[model samples]
Target: MQFIDLKAQYERIESEVRARIEAVLQHGQFIMGPEVGELEERLADFVGVRHCVGMSSGTDALLAAMMALEIGRGDEVITTPFTFIATGEMIALLGARPVFVDIDPVTYNMDPAKLEDAITGRARAIMPVSLYGQCADMDAINAVAERHHLPVIEDAAQSFGASYKGRRSCGLSKIGCTSFFPAKPLGAYGDAGACFTDDDALAKALREIRNHGQDRRYHHPRIGLNARLDTMQAAVLLAKLDIFGDEVDARSRLGRRYTELLTARGAGSTELGGDAVLTPFVHPDNVSVFAQYTLQVPDRDSVAEKLSASGVPSAVHYPVPLNDQPVFHVGLPGEETPVGARVAQRVISLPMHPYLTEETQLKVVDAVAAATGLAGS
Candidate 1:
């Protein structure tokens, strides 16, 4: 079984996707094409943001946002250490320091309570990742940013369809970025992403940064990279958007099924806590896109081995905290964020997708029970 069943999704949208691609092919304006503008506008409206600037990839989206914010040498951006390396990589690439913060044990998100203590004169931005498709406490995080005069950049790569307290993930912070990687909730066929914001000037700067800092044709004003999203990717995203909302709902339902089955609460389950696993904690104020439907289990490696043997695929979102990574290991103060470090040793992701069937989930949970010694021998 595939972890993220993109093939299943594609089957449902094949004709529509083909038609969109055909339109782009006829136009032949691959770079800075009309489809890119249309996708950006649609994405902006969906996210309740005033602007959306498309980019070549999720990494470039973050880079463009950092450039627009002028985050560079000697600057520090406070962020969680439990997320994908791209979060810290972008800051390091810009010659800025990523001040690693511990994640909350419950939600596994950046702990807002610890945010203020990490603030220094060099702290320019608060970048909180919406890990595993769930958003962090943006209200509390934003409050700290407001008091300290720092901008909040929501890394919503896994959370495009997620909502926090009636607001969308990308629209919750001062600036937000999301990916169109094939496995994301709302994804394109190829690598793509967009930066979202309400600030007019920041939006303009982001657009320029993604286009070699061009103010007009061939007029380069500042140092930037070629990060424009391709027209084909934009077309795919536009087509995906047609059923994206419905897919989000399906993901949520499927996620609930997994949780129920794993917990021994599904149909015909006689035991409780079937796998002795800890399901993802979604905050009451937020709704996740259920990008991965990950679970924390004891003896993660053994469980994963058994799942693999059973043909039930599983993976880890992060195997090590960012501070512990070799490249970013500067041994600075607050060097090791204990929560993320501890969680990394035990977290394992099960097969998750909007199209995942309940019967398939039952088999996965049964394997989890057997692997974790919860199933009665």
Candidate 2:
């Protein structure tokens, strides 16, 4: 079985995707083509934001957000350690420090309770990643940022279609960024991403920053980088938009189905005592896009083995905490983020896609129970 099954999604949109690509080719403006602006406008409307700045990749979207805010050189951005390295990597790249807070054990997101204590004088921004497609407690995070006079950037790479308290993920913060990596919820054919914001001045700044700091052609206003999103990639996204809403609904249903079946089998409940497994936690006030339906399992390595043996695919989102990474480590052990460190060792992501079938989910869950020696329970 395929882990992500991109081919399945592609097959559903092949003709429309080809048509969009053809239109891009006919325009002969591959670099900054009309399709690029069209995609930006459509995306902005979808996210309920004033503007959307398309960029080269999610990493560039993040880097440009920092540049637009002037967050660099001895500044600190508070975040969690249990996410992909890119979130923290961008902060460290700007000669800024990434101060970490512990994550909630259930949500695997930065704990809003511990957030304020990490704010020092140098804290310029609060970057909270919406891990595994569920938004972090953004309302609480934003309140803390408002009190501290700090900007909040949502690393919303995994949560483009997610919602928090009636607001979209990318529209919930000062600046939000999302990816179009082929594996993400709203993916393109190649590398691309976007930054969303309601603030006009910040949006204007981000537009210039992505285009070599140009206010106009040959009029350089500041130092910047080449981070423009490609026209072809934009075209691909435009086609995907036709079915995006339905796909999101399908993903949510699949996520709930996984939880129901696992709960029925007592696989992810405490009834068996030793953490048979743990399901992804969705807050009552929000909706996750289910970018990945992750679960925490004991004896994770053995469970992975059985899944593989049963031809049921699985993967780990992050096996180690970002603070423990060798390149960024300051030779200090990451004892502060105890929950993040503990969960990193146990969390595993099952195959999650809008097209996931009931039979496949059953097979995957049965493999899990068998792997954990709970098949008869």
Candidate 3:
């Protein structure tokens, strides 16, 4: 089975997608066309934000937000190390330092208890990534940021449709940045992303930043990058946005089904036990979009190998903590982030998509059970 069933999704939305793309082609305004503005408005409304500035990619969205906040040389942005490199890379790109924090063992999200200790006078912002389509504890993170007088930027790339408390993921922070990387929960056909904010000034700054710091044509107001989202991508996203809510609901149902099946089958070995393969945890106050349906499995490598050999595709969300990566490693072997380090070795993502069939899902669960020696149930 496909790891992510993009083909099925496309088939479901083929007519709408085709119509949107056709409109874009007929308009012949490829760059910053009408569809771009249309998408921005639609996204802003969906996120309940005053503004949504579409950008080139998720990475660019993060960069644009940082630029708008004037986060540069000598500044520090606090974040978890158990996420994609882009989370920290954006900070480093701006000559700022990424202060690594550990994640909660259960949620695999940035641990709020450890967050305060990592903040220093140089801390400009707290960027918390909503990993695997589940939001980090935004309320706790926001409290800490409020106390420190720092802004919070939710790296909501994986959690576009996720909700924290009563608010949406992208609307919970000072600035929320989400990616449309085809693999994300709410994806476009190609590279695209958007930044959301309630603050008008920050919104204005982000718009300028995305267009090479131009207030208008050729009017450079500040140093910026060409991070504008293309009309084609915007068109695709607008089409997808129409059905995103339904897709999120379908994914949630599938995630719940997986959890139920795994629990019923007792898919944990005697040596490992049922607790060893902890399913994805959803907070009582939040709703997960289940972007990856990742699980904590002992002997992750062996499990993945067995699944692959069994014709069941599986992958790791991240094998190594971002702080441990060669590019980010600063010869600091003693730097301790126990939670991140531990989770990095155990987390494995299974095939998950809104269109995943029951038969395919059963096969996936059976593979897991067989791999873990818990297939008897």
Candidate 4:
């Protein structure tokens, strides 16, 4: 079974995607074409934001947002170490420091209780990643940010369709950035992403930043990068947007099924053995898009090896915490990121997608169970 059934999703929206691409080809305005603005508008409306600035990629979207907020040398951005490197990479790229924080073991997201302690005069923003597919505690994070007068940027790359307290993922912060990586919840044909915000000035700044800091053609207003989203990709996203809601619902149902089936089989006996295995946790106040149906297992390496031997494809969202990564290891003196370290060693992602069939899921579960000697339990 495919880890993420993009093929199935393509089959469902083939005609719409083809037609949208055809229109882009016919128009021949590849750069900053009408489809770009169309997608930006559509995305803005979908995310309940006043503006959406499409960019070259998710990394660029994060960079653009930071640039718009004037995050520069000596500034610090607080975020969890359990997320993708991109979360901290963007801050480091701007010559700013990424203040790594521990995650909440259950949610695998930045722990808000530890947030205030990480902030200092140099803190410019709080970038909380919506890890896996569920959002971090935005209300508490926002409260802390409000007290410190810092902006909050939601890294909603894995959680575009997710909801937190009745608000959409990308609309839950001062600036929300989401990826359109082919593996993301709401993916495009290729590399693409968007930044959302309610503030008009920040929106304008982000637009300029995406286009090499140009207010208009050749009118360089500030240092920026060429981060414009391709018109063709935008067209592709527009087509996918038509059915994204249904896909999200389908994914949620699939997640529920996995939970029910796995729970029924018994967490330890179903797969990876029950010794210290933890199921994915979803908070009652938020809904996950289930970008990855990840779980915690003992001896992750051995479990993955067994799954591989049984022809069941499995992967890890992250094997090492960002704080421990060689590139971004600044070493937070006197701070111990215990939760991030522990989760990094145990988290493993299973095959997850809206189109993943029950039979395929069973095969995967069975393979894991057999490998971990849980088949007879």
What local distance difference test score does each model get? 0.87, 0.90, 0.90, 0.88
Better of 3 and 4 by TM-score: 3
Q: Which tens-of-lDDT digit does each residue in 144-260 have in candidate 4?
A: 999999999999999999999988999999999999999999898789999999999999999999888999989998988999999999999989999999989988888888877
lDDT of 3 by residue, 1-377 (tens): 89998899899899999999999899899999999999999999999999999999999999999999999999999998988999999999999999998888778899999999999999999999999988999999999999999999999999999998878989999999999999988898889999999999999999999998999898998998999999999999988988999998999899989988887776432222224777787888888999899877878889999999999998888988888898888546426687677777888889999998999998999999888776452
Please provide, for model 2 over 159-256, each residue's C-alpha lDDT reduced to its tens digit, 9 standing for 90 to 100: 99999998898999999999999999999988999999999999999999999999999999887889999999999999999999999899889999
What would the TM-scores of all predictions be?
0.95, 0.97, 0.96, 0.96
For 215-239, candidate 1 gives per-residue lDDT tens digits of 8989988878899999999999988
Task: Superpose all Cα atoms of candidate 1 onto the true structure and report the RMSD in Å to 1 decimal.
Answer: 3.1
Clash-forming residue pairs, model 3: none
How many residue pairs clash per model?
Answer: 0, 0, 0, 1
C-alpha positional error of residue 236 in candidate 2 after TM-score superposition, expressed in Å: 0.3
TM-score of 1: 0.95
lDDT of 3 at 39: 94
